[model samples]
Target: MMGSERSRMLYERAHGLMPGGVSSPVRASEPFPLFIKGGKGATLFDVDGNRYSDYCLAYGPLILGHAHPRVVEALRKQAGEGTLYGAPTELEVEMASLISSLYPSMPMMRFVSSGTEATMHALRLARGFTGRSKIIKIEGAFHGAHDSVLVKAGSGAATHGTPDSLGVPEEVARNTLLAPYNDLDAVERLMREQGGQIAALIVEPVLGNIGPVLPREGYLQGLRELTSRHDLLLIFDEVITGFRLAMGGAQEYYGVRPDITVLGKIAGGGLPIGIFGASEEIMSWVSPLGKVYQAGTFNGNPMSMTAGLETLRELREKGHEGLFHNGERMRKGLQNVLDDLGLGYKVQGIGPMYQLFLGREEVWDRAGAMRSDATLFKRLYQGLLHEGVYIPPSQFETCFLSTAHSQADIDRALGSYEKVLRGLRP
Candidate 1:
């Protein structure tokens, strides 16, 4: 009834070719996924020619929003020169210098192709630097898809009901410890039991995968102290929060400095990029200087460098005040709608990231997040799609706001939300 004839046909053809008719598990939906033709600013044009105000933002990369003029022009210009060289370019150095200035904790860094690669290398470097085999990860904080951090992963894993993938070896899973997010006691217990055996504790300062669950007060500082006491490296996986939260990311926002930082998503300005960085001493443990041994043919590729540089330049010049203000406005508006409807659903986020956890009042950790009504969320998602507002398909995934989103877009989305919610009231 919602007019998806073209999308339905495409999905039928695709289902036989690609698994679940999607490259990513999270993109798979009930009837069919909307095939996006193109995007500009905060809107997506589907294959069926329906336009929707996009809030998923390609899973948190397009902070400046889709196809910003500056980023597009920069990429076009860079493409004429050449795409990849298999050799280092000046773009790499410039991008690295710019990022180091913003993320002061990372004086030195290496570029990778994706967040998974960055986190994989970071975990290896941590182990090499500390000469320990174990690492700790928050229960639902997704570091990457690597064997080391896949246990209890969030995002696509949580959405599809597979927290632990079947392919990861049991031996690999054993060394990776799990602690509930926002609970330092769980981390302390793990450390107390086997602190010496652990090389690092990697966390998403704001758990962006399962939910944009904000950190409790002083929770990050407590982690820093605890990690220091146990002599384990503190790695901040800021792939989702990097530039979206602030220019300096969660580390700067929370005033907690991590030993290593893994940044992606917005860092590449919607391009495929991942970066792992730290102090010179810690980074020295990586390849060409020490024996950590991480290499990629496409590391610091020029196209991603140009896009990231331009994106960061724009953010630096414009500043993030408007983004923050818009974020608060969106969250508050959503809360007000829920209040008016008398729905117990929770609105949770900080900075530019937020998620509406249907049927839950408070969600601080993965357990709480999972307790939300997924069935009701699916109904709301479909209703929103029909109303020309596109949010992430899964309730477990976070929704984002961008500089491209305007006051009108926010208000329109809120109105659509209220209408759909009222209709669903029983």
Candidate 2:
């Protein structure tokens, strides 16, 4: 109430029209949304000028944090040239080339405006490429808000997907097969039974959306083998992990390449950009060459390319050494605090992406992550926010870090976690 004037006023106005007074559900917070006036490095200042060390990191788009000088300069310079050409440009070519060089699995790439567009288009291309109707997706791994992938698993393994969201017909969902994450046996069984009709097997590789869960050792390798043996395309939804974990994203980190990698979040440098890429053999199935079609008015907006290219240039120049080191430091610091508290919780995630799970056991899949103590995580989130260290509002979402976060910010968060843990204890 003290420092939330603009946010409060805007939210009050929003309640009349918006579903939850926020553009996205995750942005909705306790009491109301926190309206930010500005951000620099790892910190955000609300309209009241109250500062916060941001661990949400704009939901993973701010890998370099707010208003990065390079990105700002690049965007400004590009604005002078033009915003959208309504056609191809050299900048788009450069960004595509950059992505291809980094991701060897991606010989050709197409740009889209959001992760949703990327995944949707990729699925279409996969269907066209394989000439198959049915596709497999892991349960609880959100590809996007799209209808085709929104299908949910049935009451039993033999049943087809039911409409997970309203308005999506059962027909679209029927073509979608659901499997549980990290369960190789389940995936293999699905492939064995439905291999002939399956178009692709799309996964998050590092399952961040339903709370941070790493791929079990050899799990990705198993997926690769299964897809290959069954002749089904493997699509990695690396929208969250791409560029955040390393230069090539989860494909680079895990060394198990996917047939098509859908990217977003970090590609925009906090603007709007998404991409899906694969080898030329597969990617050639898309339009301007083949029949599988997709297009966007702002697909390769110059501003985003300028910012994104500069951001990638920075990552390449620095080689992600500091970013990963910072993540490790945070993980070790958090583990130490949890140990000292003797709390029954496990911190899970890949580098630069993590979630504090209040579960006693390590999480393997969505079911395991859901079993974590949500009450404890909610308490933890409220506690940290009060202390000016903001984590994701939901236990199901991962907290992000950027190269912008320094030792001071990490230490501050560690201290906050210590206190929050003590308060949660009976």
Single out the weakest 10-residue window by summed lDDT for candidate 1: 154-163
Candidate 1 segments whose C-alpha is farther than 4 A from its true place: 153-163
**Model 2 weakest lDDT span, ten residues long:** 151-160
Clashes of each: 0, 0
What's the residue-level lDDT of 337 in candidate 2?
90
lDDT of 1: 0.90
How high is each candidate's TM-score?
0.96, 0.97
- What's model 2's TM-score? 0.97
Q: In candidate 2, which residue ranges exceed 4 Å CA deviation?
A: 1-6
lDDT per model vs. reference? 0.90, 0.87
Candidate 1 lDDT, tens digit per residue, 282-334?
Answer: 99988899999999988999999999999999988888898889888889999
Question: Which lDDT tens digits does candidate 2 get at residues 224-282?
Answer: 99999999999999999898778998889889999999999889898888899999998
